[model samples]
Target: MKLTHWWPTALNPISNVAFLRPIDGGMKLAMLFQLAIAASAFSLHAIAAARPNIVLIYVDDLGFGDVSCNGAKAISTPNVDRLAARGLRFTDGHCTSATCTPSRYGMLTGEYPWRKKGTGVLPGDAGLIIEPGRATLASILQQSGYRTGVIGKWHLGLGDGTLNWNGKIAPGPLEIGFDECFLIPATGDRVPCVYVENHHVFGLDPNDPIQVDYKNPVGTEPTGREHPELLKMKLTHGHDFTIVNGISRIGYMSGGKSARWVDEDMADVITHRAVDFMERNQAQPFFLYFAYHDIHVPRVPHARFAGKSGMGPRGDAILEMDWCTGQVLDALERLQLTEKTLVIFTSDNGPVLDDGYVDDAVEKLGSHQPSGPYKGGKYSLYEGGTRVPFLVSWPGRIRAGESSALVCQIDFLASLGALTGTDLSQIKTAGDSQNVLPALLGESQIGRQELVEQGGGNQLALRSGNWKFLPAFAPKNAPAKARPLELFDLNQDPGETTNLASQYPERVNEMRQRLEQIQKNP
Candidate 1:
């Protein structure tokens, strides 16, 4: 179950998992026996040994220029910048999709999100999107002897259709590879705004069942559309539903008042549960997917962080996120897992302002560009919609530096396989996860040759080295494209301002041909 409160700094303790030992008699025999057992139990955990503790710090809707090291001059992200200071900071990292759901699907499954029929941004009450028997990154890591856990935003989907909130939420994260899950059903702007831990909603009163819907309202719960006066933050578009904590959400949820999560304490609540999971499983190597929900919609920063960023709710939420990162880093140090753990810092997609609420994101945006001078925000088919900050730090193995490696989030599974010394050939669907371990370790700059990028739905862009080609999507029911044919040399125009498809017809044709071949073949 999820924790009810945030851990105060005063209560946080230092870790004692030290390798330093003295030349004592009782300890000597114990050490020899322990070493023999460790050697026998596939314990390849020394330097250059088996897999390191993998922590994927996947933040939500964080922009490419959000960190201080990444041209975020308007706001500061010292904690994240410190991570960059200690590890390899990637300049050209991109997510598989421009939005949340599909990108997460690709990241976890190593398969293109569009391949699955209904894999788009899902409603909070939508049924499970993943096939029950599918193998995900978590399942793969599980087989590699890593205890897996996912904490925070799980917008993928929930129970297998006909979700009875009072019953077991099956076909959820547990069915996906996460040993345990402490998650939000969807975004903060969605309904049934409660923490689902493992199977049931934490703190849920069995007496108070939750009724949710997207089409019609629950018939009785007063909604934002009907009562605008109840709202604390006004919605500029969409997002006008049952109001909770004076914020209107996308879906309507009734009852379960005790179970509903407090938005103000969400970051802290999730962090405490994550650290607890780490502490509980510290004896063995574990994989923690610490998905932060900060910097998303309904940008309500905790009281302390409210005025921290001059850039309105967006900036304040980023400040909250930076603090969250610092807290997680502190957890690792306190647990004495700093040297043994490898933290991968990245985002699900690029940033977007006014996603749903009028939180002064656009008005208070100032000269601070969230997309870092890239061309798009949220749904655009441009570099800014996908290119984001990526960092890898493992106090010892990875040296401090910057890498221009053209890597995608989908490659993480394969890199972990190599790090754990696991046989990838034994795992199916992991074929899309190419081993970019060398790139991740700052050892090599060579990355995948071709990568498939999705905009909203079925909108595809093929990136081969420096040239990116956006072919006319011809599928009958595909999302409409604004441009017929577009091409750019990212090396020349990383902002994607100039289209070179007409200038370099031969390169365009070559890239189009290659894209079709990979799609048809893969």
Candidate 2:
């Protein structure tokens, strides 16, 4: 009468119970109860296995019209197109902000970035912005038994205010919620041009320590401004500091020569690392935030992709990014994890040319429109600034279609929480996130009733239904002008050319009040 003797090895609890013979009625009752517990445990394990692995491929400066599926003729994104063909493509998807840092902040924290101070575009030497021990999206998933990791551009900063690059860097990705991270500390155009793997620089040498500064020059390295002949890529604006890999970056860095990354090989390196993470965690559900640094400034694409597009380095970088997406998709298919994994592809913000470098992105632009049919890009508070390509694929779970549901990246935390059946009540910081799992899964055609969009200088816009409201506000240090409130019925004027704020006074007042209420409450 040992229960172990009758325990099912293959979880055939009922079949195994047939072979059990009890010595007494009490023994029979105990054996049946134990068998039921074993069956229940097996069912729980099956449910856990059914939870889909999530991979969020966040790109940098990629526009709404960059992909072939979204009507781009100059560039071909076969991989991304394939994803859209097999999944849901969002026509009205957007990031929370026009800039990178704030959009990333809002997505991860599930709160409006403007509500918090110091969440603007950060310097290269900035400290970890997301406070440690806080409830982030990664932390929520991690608590729900998902292995979490972030690979590639982690512009969310690292360590405390006083960070020593040579020593162990704490309060980084590890402290926030991610179990592991391989990051490009800030942006590609910034310094400390080295990879940070978890707590230490990837390949640091003890002989040469690292020092980074944004205010002044730290090293005797020839800069783009000082030595123009040394540069492989010319500078157009402010990125004229310490040179690494023949290109000057935004900040100045002295040492860590051994760990400096080559811009051309970055896509390959990060893609391989992302594929490896998926392979290692194939047995259990995992969350991978594969943030790409491609299509950004200093657009030094690999030779394999060079001149492949007639649109120069910017177009070539788009192809390189597509290749990275293909690599991840291939890995999923090879591992037989495609059907069991949910993949989301999107950009941090809209596209921009001549950001900081002279990469022929403007001259060779030809007739291709990076932001598609929308007006304004990158820094403007227009449709093109925050609106970007968004695709979601979960194989058999999500049907292939297009949805114009008004979705924003800020809702990811609550949506994912709903998907994983996590208890969101315990996490009190997710004030701005809404659970739009049905919208995300193609079960619903409607999303957020109202969404806020932020642009350069913290300029805010409100989108309610088919109308967009842009309140007037002069930016810091700009010449004063009579800037009136602007409104557009997006269904009629997606370009936002017609300002109807005067025509509809009531609508303008209503949206203006709503925007103020969100700002005051949120």
Candidate 3:
């Protein structure tokens, strides 16, 4: 019946004879046609199976306007700019939450961080937040035959609550499906400041075992509050607990001296590890979540990048971050994996000038707006908090252009899950993560129809189209005032200055209902 199918098996001998004789031209043509069809099908299937290498460059505390491509005139992120120039730059891209822990949780697990307890910013010694056996981005990709590795800031907690630093750290990135992990278990500013490689602290001497305690001082380590003279970088607030590397941290540690990571050399060290990962795994498809440590608190750049940005440590850190990004880009190019890799550059949350360290961010700002034209920064329920710079580059696959599609980091699970042919329906806890792969590829202008934005605690806001609605909630530390429901069209008021809650009560009510629905269901 089907010439393409039957010709190969049944008429093979006859077709060959016909070709040999050069008489039965019709048979030769049919055979040729069948072969061409078979080859085309095989080629298509091969192309479909060849999944591209994925590199998620998750930056810490970077803002929307921090890169030059996104309107930062004061500072230039050339690597990030080159990425934008070659791929899709999303203007309305957002993370699930405005804070680090929640955003990372959402990114890895494909579930809202608010749904889980203890998803808040964890200390260095806190237990793993992601439950064991949970389906994660790394896990999903690993299932599809990709080598998953996470390098750099891993603020996601490690091990059980009674975690012994000297012993094997379980239930970490390895347990969560990552094959390889070299990480800062928590934030750079936090303590027990040692690099955790795979399961144990890197370079930890067994003779001088490591000990960590967040509640109390462990040994004779000088503290910033007690000994301000020892601090090279002065603390402005809560970071005056324990001194490590001449800088005060939030927690205390005694004897991980051999394993401690220098603040300035973090970028270089992590970049080397990441590039090494790429080089080693170049033969196979890999998922490398190379999170940057620069541009975070206690902004200590290498001597090369020192004073490069006039905006003090903050600006210098941005430059350092850009350099780190360039290194990865260079590695990808060197390995000839640029066209075969999908590199996504985005931040965990928004920006903050004076987040516990006195790095002169406020006084030396010099008219550089980190959060762009949006109101609020890291901790608020405004656009600036969640709406961050998002760039996705896949060389020839994703066309270079700007897209206003409202995408979120939370959706990566579903989007990539769909991309790699994973069954999203089987993923039990993919909360609020929709597959907008087409939008990510710059094929579609529309992204999520509605998205939920989270603040510090249980506070929430709904973003539908260009309109944003925040339910009535009183300010925490502000003066006594009844802050009513607020709504603003982002297209009209990008600064979020005017509250149109009174004008559109019905719309607010609808969005509020939608928010409640998502939260309750999720």
- The Cα error of candidate 3 at residue 43, in Å, is 13
Residue 370, candidate 1: how far off, in angstroms?
0.9
Give candidate 1's error at residue 477 in angstroms: 12
Tell me the tens digit of each residue's lDDT in model 3 across 1-522: 322222221101101111112223356686776687676446434434768899999999999989999999988889889889999999999998999999999999888888888998888999999988999999999998999999999988999989998889988999988999999889999988899999999999888877788887788878889999988998788998888888999988888788999998999999999999999999999999999887899899999999989889999999999999899999999999999999999999999999998899999988789999888889878899999999999998888999999898988887787667665676778756777776788866867778889877767899989999998888678647335789999999999999998888899889889888888886
Highest lDDT: which candidate? 2
- Provide C-alpha RMSD values for all models, in order: 12.1, 11.5, 10.0
Q: Candidate 1: what lDDT?
A: 0.82
Residue-wise lDDT of candidate 2 within 1-522, one digit each (tens)?
Answer: 543334222111101112333343466777786887677446434434478899999999999988899999888999999999999999999999999999999999999899999999998778999999888889988988999999999888888878999999878999988999999999999998899999999999989999898888886887877888899988888888888999988988998999999999999999999999999999999999999999888899999999999898999999999999999999999999999999999999999999988888999999888999898888778999999999999889889999999898988888787677676766667788877666788966867778899988689999998999999876567647325689999999999999999999999999999999989985
lDDT of 1 by residue, 104-220 (tens): 988998777877788999988888887767778788788778899999999989988789887798889999888999998899999988989999988889888888988878847
Q: Enumerate residue pairs that collide in model 1.
A: 44-50
Score every model by TM-score: 0.89, 0.90, 0.90
**Candidate 3, position 270, lDDT:** 96
lDDT of each: 0.82, 0.87, 0.86
| List of clashing residue pairs for candidate 2 | none
Minimal lDDT window, size 10, model 2: 8-17
**Residue 314 lDDT in model 1?**
89
